[model samples]
Target: MPRFAGKTHTAGHIFFYEEMVVIGAIFGTIFSVFYPFFQFYKWIGNSPVWETVYIILGQLFLCLYGFFAGIFVGCLALAIAEMLNSIPIFARRTKFRHGIGVVILFMALGKSVGSFIYFLKQLFVCGGM
Candidate 1:
């Protein structure tokens, strides 16, 4: 069998990195593309060719923006992890870096959710146009 096929080591790091990248990409793309699309589509409806054009153009921008956003966030987390790993207090635990990264991610996600909730409340309760 191949050496890495059986997962001798480094599996956790690999999984953690993959998860971070996926999450970053999703959040970035959603932020840049879907949020605006939905906001405008509510007013414009789904009948116009211009709407289609807007979405296509938006996706082009969002894809590139999302790709880089994901990379940047992932890199930042990795840097934080490295910094944490260097501290003597956390040297004993191998997963400490991942834990710190996850905590930071959750904090950011929680803040985003709060904003989304507020947006929904305003849109629905205030009778948005």
Candidate 2:
């Protein structure tokens, strides 16, 4: 809903911005508060107190980092999407910006897919720690 850098944002940009902020907050909360949940991936067989402390710290750090990351993500995602759509600057058109957007989109998609796969691996993998 905020104006960014003198440019009026489209609806998609606003949506992504909101999404990133929500995601960052959620992840931050999850990481900081439930850090020990990660132990499910690999129980270090260490003291429970230490694990609890680490989980709290991790969540705190994650929440703060996520807050910051959300702001950047909103801006960058919009910029990338716009460039991909070929909204040009300068009288002389450069093809580079347009192509760069495509690359960014694919990279984002790939990472997202990879992250989902990794999450499943951690979730459904057999055997005990």
TM-scores of all candidate predictions against the true structure: 0.33, 0.32
Model 1 scores a TM of: 0.33
User: Per-residue lDDT of 15-120 in model 1, one digit per residue for the tens?
Assistant: 6656776997798688766676667666866877978888899999899979988967886786767665565455345545446657656867997998798787
What residue runs in model 2 are displaced by over 4 Å at the alpha carbon? 1-45, 81-129
Q: Give the lDDT of residue 53 in candidate 2.
A: 77
Q: Model 1 segments beyond 4 Å from truth?
A: 1-38, 89-129
Residue 49 lDDT (model 1): 92
Q: What CA RMSD would candidate 2 show? A: 11.9
Kindly give the number of clashing pairs for every candidate: 0, 4
Q: What is the C-alpha RMSD of each candidate to the true structure, in Å?
A: 12.8, 11.9
Model 2, global lDDT: 0.70
Best by lDDT: 2
Q: What is the lDDT for 21 in model 1?
A: 63
